[model samples]
Target: MSVPHAKLPAWAEYGLIPLVNLAVAFLISGLVVLIVGESPLEAAYHMINGAFGRGEYIGFTLYYTTTFIFTGLAVAVAFHCGLFNIGGEGQAYIGGIGVALACLSFDRVLPWYLLFPIAVIGAAFFGALWAMIPGWLQAKRGSHIVITTIMFNFIAASLMNYLLNRVFKPLGSMSLETRTFETGGQLPKLDWLMSIFGLSVGNAPFNISFLLALLAAFGVWVLIWRTKLGYEMRTMGHSPAAARYAGIKEAKIIVITMMISGALAGMMALNPIMGEQFRMQLDFVQGAGFVGIAVALIGRSHPAGIIPAALLFGMLYQGGAEISFEMPSISRDMIVIIQGLVILFAGALEHMFRPAITRIIFGLSPKGRQAAATKGA
Candidate 1:
């Protein structure tokens, strides 16, 4: 007879395992630095200081964190529903069109506070609409969600290129972007929020969207844990056959979940478009959609976990830039390698240490000892 697999406690599964994985990733990253003839300690010092040394650094880090939080939550929502919504890149791209339309139509007439809500709805609606098509195909036509979503991403890119070049491009402007938004369209920076920490925001574009991202996280937690639909979603994710047996409508759940995921991804555009750039630009997403997949994996698809994971990635992005500037030997590509190592270890190889850790835990528990004795016999 085969021995049953051991299970980890919730705290160990969610918290301790991830921490150990991160530590190992950093340790390996240090080895890479050593091979490059630089002191790992020195590189680490610069990275930490660069990410948090000054208030402006924190602001920039949080600004990146804000975008990641949105995208991370998007991936997390879909993951919970047993769906991999890889079309976040496309959804966010199309969502920008919604935001731009709202701003272009109302920027001259409405104040920022008033336009913000309208823009939010517009963003979410367009993103949901974009994601809904793939969800429909998967639910109704038996198409593979992964292939459809990935293809939608490329389609979104092409669509945006055409729209930007032909429709949204202002006449006589050489740039392939829309006209810059006025004060009404621009989001207000959270200078007061920084002031509470006794630091100025400086040139960082950190804005109200960070607060919005937090709100979205809370909303997700409530939706996933506190609501009936969430229960159905979790059931479907755990076992579609059981869900169907329990009378849960898989088709409805898939579509709704994907729409919610897409909506979250779409809102990410608000940070860069309204919060910073004050205009939609090509490739403003900067791969946050793909980064979100790693974020969700590292976070274990929990809203609480995703917040810190997003912050960690934000640090990597900001600090990596600093590393490139401070140490010419470690170029931008080198920084990318460092980031990739972290993703490889933390995301892909996440369970590599689980069996060893499980054995250690089992060795320490009385019931586990008894079970082992029984298995051995």
Candidate 2:
């Protein structure tokens, strides 16, 4: 009486749909380029060349790349344990405040040797506390962390406003900014380090934090893939009840994962404050938490995959600035458009590839079963 629906093609499950999504994005980017009165190929070519071709652009790209690595990894870590940590912004703000406070306190007392590490650790600890508060609420009180973290972001912003406005402002300066310490506290120029490697660049903040980021990425990879803790975390992520039956302690794992995620979020601040700017400003996290979701999605929640995804984001960021310069009329919104498209495609890629993936994993499809039945005849 009724026709049966055909199963989705195995190719569709393998991410063929994502390719279609990408084609759609390219057409849209092309349209945008044309609307801006530039050749699509030319604009795209220049964008690619600028982002990856030039040494200066390369430096800028890496600068952002370093920050995004932490944010993306932060998001990915929580995702690994089936926890959603949307509080990365708040955690980063708290870390920023800690680093700011530390810089103001010990900048004069301690030599640069001790000051830098202390500030970084202080920042990370503060971030962990901020993140853990929400995590605790979720674990202990059944509070929705997503909602709480969003609220915390606002609270942290208000707290920053208070600090900038009254508490930390230098008297008679008529500015919220603290006095930049002239000696001993400044981050050692990575450019000098770069000179040892034959890289010459100025006004950019390349620092030891760059190496720290790579090491952190590797560390996250090892933690997620190579440890029993990682196995328990994954099991809990897939099914908390199942994990419980398998002897995985959900609460302990949840708290630990949340703390680690928060710390990773805190590490994001180092790239901006300690690495380049060397001074604190309010609102420095700059939506990195939200951007991190896209980064994680594109990375498929893999730490190693985060590198390329972060690089893609960093390139778009640099390209947006350059495009803004070349075509003042064109809004930086193009970057937003492209990023949205990438997230959309990457998210759908699994669905696109799902059938083949499932069949490969399971060794048969519905059609495969039917064909085998016919072959037996």
Candidate 3:
């Protein structure tokens, strides 16, 4: 009861499969739009317009893309090490504390440039420390990484809630956030960059963090593809036993990988806190952590792929808001459903169409035909 299956080329494996899955997801989403008594094509037009019609919209879209890029790289890094670091939301949450402390301590004394690097270090350090516990447990105690990471997320949320409400809350302020950061602590907005190019974006929250995100992506590319540690991580992911046999230390790799992943997730705090909010606040992470899972899956866990994948999801988010505003029948929840569909197709059902693709490829290949003949015989 065995049949020969064709092997896809590298391009098809990395590029075409994801494209086909995305196309299928959009087609189904269009059907759902029809059921809601709306024109899918019109809805698509609105979404595109909302995300990129004006300078401000483009700015906002890139702003969201920046966060997604950080979080996506976080997840992708963990995936390469065969670890599921689902605690990115928690890591980002706690990273804010580092950002807050650094800003509060030096905001008045230090220049913006000096304070900025300190805050960045704080964020990465705290996030890495938070993730280290779970990573240690998984490596030394044989605990499941997914379960431990998920538990850490809840712990982080409760910890943040207590800190923000009891310790950081300013007098006479009912909000669950720290006082606004001093001028030196705040990041410079990208409005100047826009103005320099004769493009006005009307106070969009996009800032220097966007450039940092791009830099991070490039850094990850170098780390994952051009370094010895990256080779070990990928080897362990493929076969832990093989890695051990090859003299790679599994425990050390696991911990180091998670720390790096946590650091990336922690950096996401810079965008909302320093760049936009200018203060530490609850729920700042929103759901970018979870969305990162889908991004990593769809991007095939590569930095080059992650950048565009992050941009695509950013479009969906910015455009989804616009669609809900313009169409009476389409609620924000409907947009959520569409996003869920994309996740489903790209992640859970990714291989659903592979068998058919294999069949077609097999019919056209000599090696596959030889294998098929052997099977038939």
- Residues 304-360 of candidate 3 have per-residue lDDT tens digits of 899999998888888888998999788767656766787899889998888787667
Worst 10 residues of 2 by lDDT: 1-10
In candidate 2, stretches whose alpha carbon ends up further than 4 angstroms from where it belongs are 1-27, 192-198, 348-377
lDDT of 2 by residue, 1-377 (tens): 24222344555533354455556666787898888787777667667776766556767777878888888898898999999888888888778777777778888888766877887787789888888888888878889878988888899889877887786667886756556654445666566655675666555565667777788899989998899998888888888889999988777888788888888888788777766666777688887777777788777778767887788788877776777677676567887788777767665543554444434533466666675345433
At residue 52, candidate 1 shows an lDDT of: 93
Q: Which run of 10 residues does model 3 get worst, by summed lDDT?
A: 1-10
Best by lDDT: 1
Give a tens-digit lDDT track for model 1, residues 8-30. 77888898899898888888888
- CA lDDT of every candidate: 0.89, 0.75, 0.88
User: What C-alpha lDDT, on a 0 to 100 scale, does residue 32 get in candidate 1?
Assistant: 84
Q: State the displacement of the C-alpha of residue 147, model 3, in Å, after optimal TM-score superposition.
A: 0.9
Clashes counted in candidate 3 amount to 0
Q: After best superposition, candidate 2 residue 372: deviation in angstroms?
A: 12
Task: Give candidate 1 misplaced runs (Cα > 4 Å).
Answer: 1-4, 365-377
Clashing pairs in 1: none
Which one wins by TM-score: 2 or 3? 3
Clashing residue pairs in all predictions, respectively, total: 0, 9, 0
